[model samples]
Target: MRCDTLLLSAALASVATAGRSLQHVGRKADDSLAAMYNNVARNYASFSGHHDEPLHKRSQHQFLSNKTSSFAVNGTGIPDVDFDVGESYAGNLPITSDPKDPNQLFFWFFPSTNPDASKEIVIWLNGGPGCSSLEGLSQENGPFIWQYGTFLPVKNTWSWNKLSNIVYIEQPVGTGFAVGEPTATSEEDVAQQFLGFWKNFVDTFSLYDYKVYITGESYAGMYCPYIASAMIDENDPKYFNVSGMLMYDPVIGPNDIQGPIPTVAFVDYWTGLFPFNDSFVEDIHARDAKCGYTDYMNKYLSFPPAGPQPFILPGQDSDGVTSDECANIFNDVIYAAILVNPCFDIYQVATTCPLLWDVLGFPGTISYLPEGAEIYFDRADVKKAINAPSNVTWASCSDISVFVNDTDSSLVPSIHALPHVIDTTKNVIIAHGALDMVLLANGTILTIQNMTWGGKMGFQSPPVEPLYVPFHDDPVEGSIAGSGVMGTFHTERGLTYAGVALSGHMVPQYAPGVAYRQLEFLLGRIDSLDSVVPFTTDKNFTEQASEADLGEGNAPQGYASNWTAPASDTTTVKTSPAAKGIELSLASLAGVLLAVFYLA
Candidate 1:
């Protein structure tokens, strides 16, 4: 994948470096998008409508499923399956990072699943500041796999694990697989746990001194860089050889630059979504100088601040619920995704929904209906560690937070006294589904733009350049649709920041192909020419191929190349018990709703 294209001479004409405290790199295009963007604009506009319907509807299948990281521990264990498993591979080595939380850490050692046995290790992170990496493992890359309504496992054609040795860590003490250790309360505390886990992980798996690359998105934007920085500080010249860090749609800085720029950026995003609501923008801007963002955000967005805000799920039709109803809808979607996708697993699994409800401040109303059913994709350890709360679903929030802090201290509380830092040596890519309101990429972009960079030696200097590249070329408009829009100049020297096109904050779940493709491109850039692939000919197909050849001696002796097709569902349902149970429950729910509507 070698390209001899020269830098397009700073795509935009050089700007004057005058009294401006911050150098802004952006296109001065009118807000009215031209023809090239029609498709993307349409996609962006209608993004909320897509999610109302299920993914299975989009794919024209019974339901969407990811095979590699499916959750099926309760009823029957998933069959051991094989795929490229990364070229010259054998078996996967699964181990725990924390001895106390044994099931929290899960890693797939890919010594080049492709025919080429490469030695570079890249860690994959999914962002939520509180989400799971398993989503990335199964949905984006590796062998694709997903569960059908929490029971069966499916396969994915795209798996990053296949390209590199990827470790999916459920972090912090409270996230998926990991038990919320009573000890952690702040970011720094979690940092120590992450380091401890990584140390054990490498030592136990004989990977103490491997070439490491940390990568992730959303809050991971904060997670990846923080983890990399922490690893560098902790490892330095010892345990792990740290190469660099990569972040996608990262939440680095809070967009509170010198002036009201951060304020302006946030307002721009909010207004873009709610075009007519300049009143809020004006009101916030008026006090942005005095009150500040942290205060303003909590008041307006979170509970106890302002009233509830309307939630928008892109690619789905709006149900037009009240503010309270909107909040309920957002909460419901999150709960449904977590609960219904029993095969779906996340950071840490609470014992019951009520426990999760307790965490979120909800009470007895939420049902633990799927009662005895297991969260399929959740780590067994997290399940055991937390005692498995019924009302709550499992996720990797703790891990995400810990990793974010480890990547960089910018997110740490008191550390806020210091200026934000970006590792210029690393290229950060953040992608998301535009339709996803659960975690908006807009917020992510605004976050990155606002971070302050304390210039450091060796790291790329801050405020380097921001480039806007279209995703694809469109002939009629001479522009690309669903491409890039936002970028930050070097926050610290050497760091590269990129935001995905037409994506929500959760890039993998939204645009898996784009995510993996961007990652592959990023790896090429990070490793420099050292990791470049050579063009080869597929003798049988007589086609030219760009395959990375890591040479023959380093290759494994031999690998099992057999592939298996998943078996069809054949379990006969014992309808008598389940039918009677559901029938009564449905009837009860109907009576309640009818009573509420008519009697009221």
Candidate 2:
């Protein structure tokens, strides 16, 4: 139940596999895996082992059973469904053919409000590596935001499904209402399963003509790329026309190393919450000087100090230091900063004081949400209406054990995979909330600046340009009479890097209007990328509003407001008991690995 306890369990499990290389860790597939592989080889022989074979061909549970219904939809619990009866589908689609270890993935599909079926099919995923897309559906960008206080759903005016058919899929094997053992231990496996799910999804819905755009926030950043790559590798344009991908506040880099450094610096520099003492600052500088971290912020990929060089912390010595020790120093500073901040919501800096600190330290579920979503979704009536499995309990995030044995936690294959996706896809857009500390905009910018795509290593022009989105108040919903600067965007060769202002990890939940316009641009619904001009406004004339009037409150709770400076200058850096346990676990894992190496 405790975050540290779960992390420790995961660490121990990971360390147990340290002796074997990833390639050889599970090379000899189990019976079920072998059967799945053989199925692919037999049916899709031409594409077998080509990475382009439809994952469904490899799945043992290739047939899909329909569990859809048109029962009385719960108005109080359902948001945006004004009509009593409408087209909606929810059920489990088998991802693998293995009968013994069937991986049935859960999905909720909402048909586009447009009846013509002319719109593209947009799939939204939430990244916890273990989290559910249902969170995105109910709390963030879905048609309804669950209001637990009244046990009612509020209409999300800017739902992505407004102009596109949106499907929220609970992926991998054990996430959300999906049923199976938590068998997937890597992102590659996840992609394979997702492709299989997609094949079933299209077949079941008969949506072969619809273009696909994959989008998600957080860990989905890592997921979208691999999924896109699979689609590209499959080379089936008729079945998989992946036009674009859009991600907000995604985890693009590997977690254990260079990824955490830029985030720590950005938070400390921007929030001023963790005011390091002069000695600490000087110590960091000395270490940086000695460790040759001259371009630490911009140049992070050239890290791990090449060879025999010792790893150094900013304010600490390099003597007898291991790579893990240096990584801890970077991670600790960020962790300590969160502990010191009154509102520990790392995704949104302006949160006054967060209530759900229990969610922290869990991968991908760090952001806060309304209280009653879990309860509401679990209700038998609600589950039945959506055709969810009666036996399975729905959760916003998956259990830590689902990922404890994961081999890809420290891997950044997604980053390397993006260029290939970009090369094949029509367009790719990466957006970040400017104020998010969890995955800072600065880090994202630096990563993009260092990336190679479209025959160029990086953008030739400046990486910052003003991005504008039409502003509209709730009173005047449809029309955009005025414009406001959303953030900055940098573009080159069908790839765009955007910074969304007054937002956090969940872009749609915070700045829905801007997010909607951004989606329009990515979908090619809008003509120009720089400007968004709304078509019409409410008949009741409204005057242009000031910045304060349009900011913060528009965002969900725990996501709006200015950072309230702590009253006292004296800052106390205290590590949580959970954090201490995590530290001890890491140390123990490292010690064991060292002993193994020496013994070998």
Candidate 3:
């Protein structure tokens, strides 16, 4: 099966001391290291010293530390981040009602930049079934990004914070910043525990009846649906008012749906990257025909599914173990691909020779980080700034299992939960990055075709509309660089399928402009992906927003080359007041940074 929860096992433990990080892929850390991390987490200080902080920043942090109360964090800016990060809240909340419970769920909440979507809450989760949502915060569609090869963190002008009050949660227990023991063995347990934590979160902020949108990527596709079903079952708007949902490259059905059935097609589409010999390609193609995968695609992967679907049976397959030799073609291709290209990445198949250094240790398939690079989140100083636990050494994905059993006692999301969620919310987006090989787009389509939602089995017509990103006035990137046909999308019965072009496993990291446009459609700003909405204009700003005309495809030559000193809009950025006594001027500081990004 395709393990979606495979994540950062260890990126920095060895990078600092010329050692190597633990190479545990798809599971928890090795036993000895896990024990050490757990022991340290249980006995560390609430905050740590960051000697490298600037004097002014130190003063600001001091002011924030002096004034502390429940649920208050980041009263100032993050340590080592030169620009204003804006005000935010981060801390662990106990899953149990007891005040002294050690089982805690960690969260980081950032308010919206635009006042219009302030009441709307977007909860973001990352799947590894163990990966930390903080990864989503720092690298995906967050306020800032420390990209794989980038020297310094750069502003993500298309941060989701611009549209809604977004919160990232590391969940199901043994995740990043989470402190607890494994207990459950099913998705049901995962959902109930999450609901308990969510109850605490909403009450803390007094969100009695806010419109909530649940979003995530990878294995989170399985998570978002179940969580949504649980909320809908509650029938309590005050506690679980979910209005919409979105997932990227989700695992809604059996693994084979997104793996074997369409893998050959995927490889064929990107032959430039695989470097397969003609004979090898021909043999694999012959294997495909013998396996019946070719017939499966021809019959089932239709505009409207040809018939009722069940699990895929590869190689004229049966009983999960077919006699046919080509049954293992999917993995066979991977083994061959890796042999040919040592640096091949299944998440993004286009990856080539010379792997890039990553701060998160596991850059691609192996653990790696160049010398002098620090894992930002693991540093005690960073933990203090974010109000994360220091007792346990943090890994992007938990080294210990979150569940008592490796396998879940629940059906895949598509069969039961996802359809219910789609019918209830009436606003759902299931997006997939075109370049993601781990979960092929065609496989996802097959799953969708099999599932029933809104009284329909599958899409009546094919997705044809172009996903457009309008030209904006920016200097460094220029209008042309950011404006164009980002992808394509289609909607039927409240379900939208967006195929993001040139994006890999993580859409936001590879195609921020496309992700931004997707958010615009999800938040009900524009009618659909084809709507010509400017970066900022939405239904909320009727007069000022409507007047801004956006180009359809590309602007005239040199239209973006002409640079002029941009005028500043002294608009105030709205943020929460710091707790206790000393309140930092986060609103003003955030405003200054916002002005520079041309995000007014």
Candidate 4:
């Protein structure tokens, strides 16, 4: 079924302008913000866990017989139900690891739409340190997406569950439907809690043999590395085979600290916005010069609060600097510039804002799906059907106090755990949306550039290479129509860095097709990371393209100007197929026209 063109157009336009038009102001008094940081630090320092206990002894589980009673009639008696064509299981499972902090983590699991006993199992989390992973399910790559203003779901043709069993868990104690006093203050605590949950989930489901892949976006960037590391360190391969991890628009620390400032500057110059004045830009450059490195901003931002001082600016003599200046520049100058440009979205520049500023102070704009899903999930009948707690309110994004009090340890660097992950896992994919300004692609690239894996410090050769996705329209027989350059990929020593074009922080929602193809490549369904030549209906083209990594199919016929190849010596330019003179169907034409008109 086609989407509502008018709704789509409006969404595109709004999302495009959402982050633009902020009013920048001068610096403010440091005491208030400084106090906030001090409180945060105190919260961080106050956190204590059962660190003395052995890792294996920390996890405890209790199976609720009542919770399984509502499951759809599958022989296994799991909370399984048919949502359209696929099977789903939704409810809460208890983690009694720390009896003092008993928590029930909510999970929504969907079996692969295409049944395969040996298909991989993917566990997905969304990073807020408090955000619900249900957003990833209903809004991003889940089988059914919530239709705004309607109490119905639309089938997402490109759902990730097509070839993998996907599980979305609302983690930490206080997130989503999970109930308990929030106690996890560090990623280590978060990982320990997850390990407890995983043991119960896998044992109950009898899924010990399935190959598992840990995945998430944003803050999950931190969570994934730590979780993957813990799984590797604790679980035996015979019982829990952790294949890999995939991070989308992640907040990998250190590199991500002051990364936004330089990213904003580069984007402004590239897009001809010149948002920063000469004085501010000169100050930034002068600071960089004093630090003797271009990435000094990130270094400064990465520093933790030592006593009262949170950060020390370059060339400063005393450690009396407050974090207020850094916060002001990020909010007032950098973010404000993006807010002023209706054409630029901080998450995805090509799209308009789909979110409105909340009356409550949420750092980013809240999405409509979470609100709609909350309504749908909270319905009495739906709750009965899913066997969920009827009284608990379903929240898309959790309360900020959860972060302030229970997740302050997120400030601790999680990137330090990636090396251990790379050494153990089959592969590690660090992907970012090219248009994402929140966690910029350049920052991810920098992080990867500085990483060491397989006894090597970095890639010995040039890393950037054009990544192509098949044109959905008029795919050639047996071969794909290389329609456009969707993104770029660089792989070295089991570590891969990818830039997804035409996407935002929520990559699966913005560019589902490319995102799906990227996952296929990561899963080894496709031969190479750069080119995607799916087996097409046309026998001749498939045979030809199958022979070489560079397929024999003609370049894309109709969509040439959509994606441009990056300027690099290693980049390979492919010729688009000759135009077949096939006009788009009226419905397709109308949708295209609406998008163009609204975007223009």
Residue 12 miss distance in model 4 (angstroms)? 21
Per TM-score, the best of the predicted structures is 3
TM for every model, in the order presented, reads 0.47, 0.68, 0.78, 0.67
- In candidate 4, where is summed lDDT lowest over 10 consecutive residues? 577-586
Clashes of each: 104, 11, 7, 21
Q: List per-prediction Cα lDDT, in the order shown.
A: 0.35, 0.54, 0.65, 0.52
Ranking by lDDT: 3, 2, 4, 1
lDDT of 3 by residue, 1-600 (tens): 223211211222222224344344786669998677445522422222211121121122211232234446653467656667665778999787775788889998876656556567889988866777888888887776676655666656667876677999988788788888878677778888888888888777777788888999877876788898999999999989888888988877765566667877778777788889888899888888877776777677665657787553665345554433554667667767766876666667788756676666545444456666777789888888888888778876666667675556677888888988878877788878787766778777778878898777887555545667654432213111244566666677778877777778788767777777777667776666665545553322112222133222221101111211124312211110110000000011111110000000
List ranges where model 1 is wrong by over 4 Å: 1-111, 115-117, 127-130, 145-154, 235-238, 254-374, 378-492, 525-600
In terms of lDDT, the poorest run of 10 residues in model 2 is: 591-600
lDDT of 2 at 528: 38
Candidate 3, after superposition: displacement of residue 532 in Å? Answer: 1.1
lDDT of 2: 0.54
Question: In model 2, what is the error at residue 141, expressed in angstroms?
Answer: 0.9
> Candidate 1 at residue 560, lDDT?
12
